[model samples]
Target: MSANARTVHPLGERLGKVLPPLMVLGVVVAVWWAVVVKTESAIFPTPWQVVTGAMELVEDGTLWEHIRASLFRVGAGFGLAVLVGIPLGLWMGWVGAAYRTFNPIFQMLRPISPIAWIPVAILWFGVGEVSPIFLIFISSVFPLIVQTTSGVHTIDRRYLRAAANFGVPRSVLFRQVVIPAVLPEIIVGMRIGIGVAWLVVVAAEMIALRSGLGYLIMDSRNAGNRYDLVIAAMIIIGTIGLMLDGITRLLEKLKTVRWRYVR
Candidate 1:
């Protein structure tokens, strides 16, 4: 091979990763613009109309307020889920009796949709931030518990046996051996949980409360038939969710857990 063929350009590598998505996005926008122009429909917005709608929200400062409220609910709910679920899952996995006792209850509740809890949440928390927060929590917690417990159960028995043979204390064994082995799975669970939390918060805000992107979409459509704003809200929600997942994926690159990510 030529010397040039043996070397890779950083800029070219980055462009290789970036160009395909941009090309697809361009195609999508072109098709959307064509459809709007051909149909002459007032309800279905062109790409430019959506941009204009987003700019309007930015100018009024309402966009940031809605984003902040939605993010706060997701963060609070998902944080609570991580704190509670990890320890409970670890205990259940480490103890056979605890696993049998709690596994059935979790299985029963896990299948229930977060949207189904909206009415009860409103009744319990009475139509405020707490109601939506509760809904996000329920949506995220089950997946975390399931994933964490499974991770612990799947750890190699040899590791535990080695630790025991070395006369390691129970707490030390768990802290050093068990936790490091499961860290990757915990990060995966958190990624899934946060996505679910984001989804639930939107629906919860639509039903139980106001002042989020969900509310913006609903209220804009109901009050003014503003399809542009509704679409803008959807785009914002998707973008934020992608960013959240990207943050969690960074954990896979950390040196401590990076081995688990090796193909």
Candidate 2:
């Protein structure tokens, strides 16, 4: 293709990728506006009202504060889960004895809702910031552990045999073979964990803490029945969650991690 054709091709592809989502978003908003107007809903917010409410918070400088608080909690909690969960999962997956001993326990704990722990969190951590952080950790950690363990279990046995035939040290084999092989799944786990962390933090903020988007939402409701602010907060939460998942996805592009994805 000519240089001009090449440039136009990519530009056209970019627009093609972008326009469909924009078009759908437009349709959704048009319907939302129509329903609010047709029903003469006083409590439900129109899209414009939600935008205005968000702008009000923006002007007051509270929007960024709440966003930052929520992001920080998710970062801390998800970071801790990564630090603890991945290694534990690796160990459990590599060692049959460890898996046998702990798998049942985690399986039981994983089924319980993180929200169900709010009362216990308040009792133990006492309505402090730590309560929400703990909840985020709880909500986020299990998926990482499960996914990482599965990743290890699914490693090709031929790779292990080849390493053994080469007299590769166990540590070297783990570093060069096992870790790289599992990275895609680790990224997947991180994506899931971070999403859960974000959800837990919001719910935790709603009940136990007094800052973040969740608190902004609750405060807006209790103070003035501001459904617009509530909707805006919900939108912000979803947008941030999508952004976080996208960031985790970018890790799959790493040279070491790309094989599983590209193939």
**Largest lDDT belongs to which candidate?**
2
Candidate 2 matches the true fold with a TM-score of 0.96
Which regions of candidate 1 fall more than 4 Å away from where they truly are?
A: 2-4
Ten contiguous residues with the weakest lDDT in model 1: 201-210
**Scored by CA lDDT, what does every candidate get?**
0.92, 0.92
Q: What are the candidates' C-alpha RMSDs? A: 1.2, 2.0
What candidate 2 gets wrong by more than 4 Å, as runs, is 1-8
Candidate achieving the largest TM-score: 1
